[model samples]
Target: MDTTALEFSLPNAAAEPDPFSIADLSPEIRFAVLFFQRDHYCTNCREQVQAVADRVDAFRARGAEPVSVVPEPLDRVEQWQAEYDLPYPLLADEDAAVGDAYDQPVRFGLLGSVSDFLGRMPQIVVLDRSGGEGDPEVVYTYSSNSTFDRPSIDELLATLDDLAADGETTSTDG
Candidate 1:
């Protein structure tokens, strides 16, 4: 997918209509790692988020910030964050527009007949913001076809290292 063309208006607890664009977030974050999850109630989703929470320091060390996007209401987003002790912001994609933007799978091909079913498969996006202003550039995009498909924490950390080696720098200024 052409991530540079991506745009979303999800809500954070403290802000309404928070854009994924790094330029809009203060302190000029160097990178934005967006994690798209199926639902907050899923055990695997909780585990995946916990993994991200555990390695958040590693991401921050590499000048990247991790944000989670879920197809839940703002209340649920906030509740889930507190319940799981998530270390980063979780955006409320209630309409699933962001999910559609990231091309999340909606149905299993053979199981398409499942009643009222909608695929909320998970995925991760790593955006390089060191490009300096304007829209952030997507350096990595991982979309999972199944519930169990997710990049390991090690793999994500290594990707952050690679981006840093490629000259992505974290910002300490507001």
Candidate 2:
């Protein structure tokens, strides 16, 4: 895949720029852990959000920044931020364009496409951008088959560790 389409700009709950763009991140952020939510009402999505929040530091420690993308409007996303106070970026993909770009699957075909709650699944995309230039590569992607399915944070950390061990670490102190 070209992967260029993955880049996007959306409203953010915690960012100096107010609106957050995935293309803009710390130089030290070699990996961007994009947690794509199904919707605001998803219990699994909420738990995953908090889980990522709890371990945002660990992700940063491994040269990764966890970003939660809620496929809802700005107001709904703000409510989540007010409740969880996520330490990392909380983006509102209001039109779900980003999710579709990343190929977040629709299980039941046309029926599933009608409602995000009944069909849209969770996804995690780890984008690797080792330097200040170039498009972030899609290093890792996990698309949930079921609503309740999700990989543990430890598993994601291990993936980062493995990537670093394989000499793919591109994080720099610029």
Candidate 3:
């Protein structure tokens, strides 16, 4: 069975308020973000982040805003923005609070010891415009060890299409 076909459990809404809920954003559009570690960088992470940023317009065309969230400092984010030539905002989650909210965890199991810990895998999350309080659907997910088989840009676009086709109007800000 393909991992892509597996349904991911939504985050517990009561666990904590979504970081996006605190932002003053447009309620007319859906929101999505590629969450990543702040200081730790990996070639695969860079590739995945760039891929999403490059094709964000495709999401916008479908009435969604795509962004990248990292646990980096403002200066580092600016450097990355210039280096990557990012078009959308690159958020700074300084304390990894956002990452924690997303259930990102660094596991030492694979390394055989706590000293050999590796960062959490990359993940993409989609949020409905209207915040009614509950888990938002996880349209796509891939483990850190499974980066080689991560979905392509086309595949992600298709997934978004399927998610939007469900005929449910995302909640709206009243």
Candidate 4:
């Protein structure tokens, strides 16, 4: 997928996120790590988010900001904000358009298509904005195969480290 072509503006639940659109990202943010959640009630998703919250500083050290996208209403995402108090951005993708644009996985044919909880798997997309003044590009992508299948914070850090090591490592199969 050409991530450069994707654009979305969501109601941010946490603080200002610089909003992941086609426009150029802020100068400080080298990479935008987008976490496509499975659903509002997935325990794994909750744990994963908490884990990210714990190691957010590590991500910042690497010039990466982790953003969680929940395919639910604003109120739902607000509840997440109240619970996690995430330092980074937590977005409310009410219609799941952004997730769809990024092609967030849906495992169960009909059931998954109808319900995000049943079908939607996790996706971790790393957008590289190191190319200053230009729109950030999708440098790495990780679409989970199952509910509990997702990348660890360390692994995500490694990918960002790799991105810094050499520019433009585009891999959709991550």
Candidate 5:
């Protein structure tokens, strides 16, 4: 999928919340690090979400809001969030529409297809909306075929830091 072309709208994990659209986030958020995750059944996915939750402050310091996107219903999504004590938003992409837009991988074969039906494969996308307007630029993107695959926290932080630095330089040059 074309990262530049995709836009998204998923229900935020918050109670009685409205749909969180990428357009709505773009203007205010310097960066939105979206974690496209499979269902809670995937232990690695759960761990990955927790890892991001652990460093929520660090990401906030860098002007990035890390939000997890799960392919589950709102009720289940809320249950998972409360159960895990996740600090960040876990948007419900129930139909996997957002997942499909981002081209998050899906397993093949019968069992794989069952997994696919349950949810999407794991991936991470960092959108630089500091520029603001239009579709926020895709500063970074990573997809994994296996459940165990995920980028280290250090790597994610470095990418955000690098993007922040680049933004600073660009703004100052103007």
Candidate 6:
């Protein structure tokens, strides 16, 4: 499926009573890293998180913040944090509410028969922090397999730079 056609609505994190929100987040070009893990048992989970963190660092160097949202417990997130030595904050979605908001379904593998669903694909939602509420421009989106097909940190950073530059010009004009 063409990822560009996928529509997303912000998830209701209110259930968790977290202070984090689109408003609480530091306003600058921001990227939402959303991942759905069935059991958090993937062998490459740590590696993928680190790869994302590395990309986030590239964005940070350019003044952009990347927020990773994972559908897992705080403990799991913490474990991943320590294992991956991530620099960015990781939000926990214990109920998978946030993931569901993005229409990210749980995948069922061999464990599917016993478990609820399988892990979701790694997806990124780029928001122009300066854009209005109706719909933040989705600069990019990728499928679960896209993790392997994921763009390099350098490429993602360049793309974000272009988007931010474009936003600055447009905002100034308006």
TM of each candidate vs. truth: 0.80, 0.90, 0.66, 0.91, 0.83, 0.65
lDDT of 2 by residue, 1-174 (tens): 455436788889854356787667878778888888999999889899899888888999999988888889999999998998888888998888889888887778888888787788888887878645778787677888876888899988998898766734332110
lDDT of each: 0.70, 0.81, 0.51, 0.82, 0.74, 0.52
Instruction: After superposing candidate 3 on the true structure, give the runs of residues whose Cα lies further than 4 Å from its correct spot.
Output: 1-22, 37-40, 109-117, 130-143, 146-149, 167-174
Q: What is the lDDT, from 0 to 100, of the residue 2 in candidate 3?
A: 22
How would you encode candidate 5's per-residue C-alpha lDDT over 49-168 as one tens digit per residue?
Answer: 878888989888887888888888888788777877777778988887788777677777557546664435788878777654566777677877677778788888888888887743
What does candidate 6's lDDT look like per residue over 9-123, in tens digits? 3333222225356555555535443434333565544566567675766777665666667666777766766666666656666666665665543345546333433445555
Arrange candidates, best TM-score first. Answer: 4, 2, 5, 1, 3, 6
Where is model 4 more than 4 Å wrong at Cα? 1-5, 17-25, 172-174
Candidate 2: misplaced stretches above 4 Å? 3-5, 167-174
* Clash count, one per candidate: 1, 0, 2, 0, 0, 4
Which structure among the candidates has the greatest TM-score? Answer: 4
Q: Give the TM-score of candidate 3.
A: 0.66
Please provide, for model 1 over 106-143, each residue's C-alpha lDDT reduced to its tens digit, 9 standing for 90 to 100. 56554632311356677787777666656777777777
lDDT rank order:
4, 2, 5, 1, 6, 3
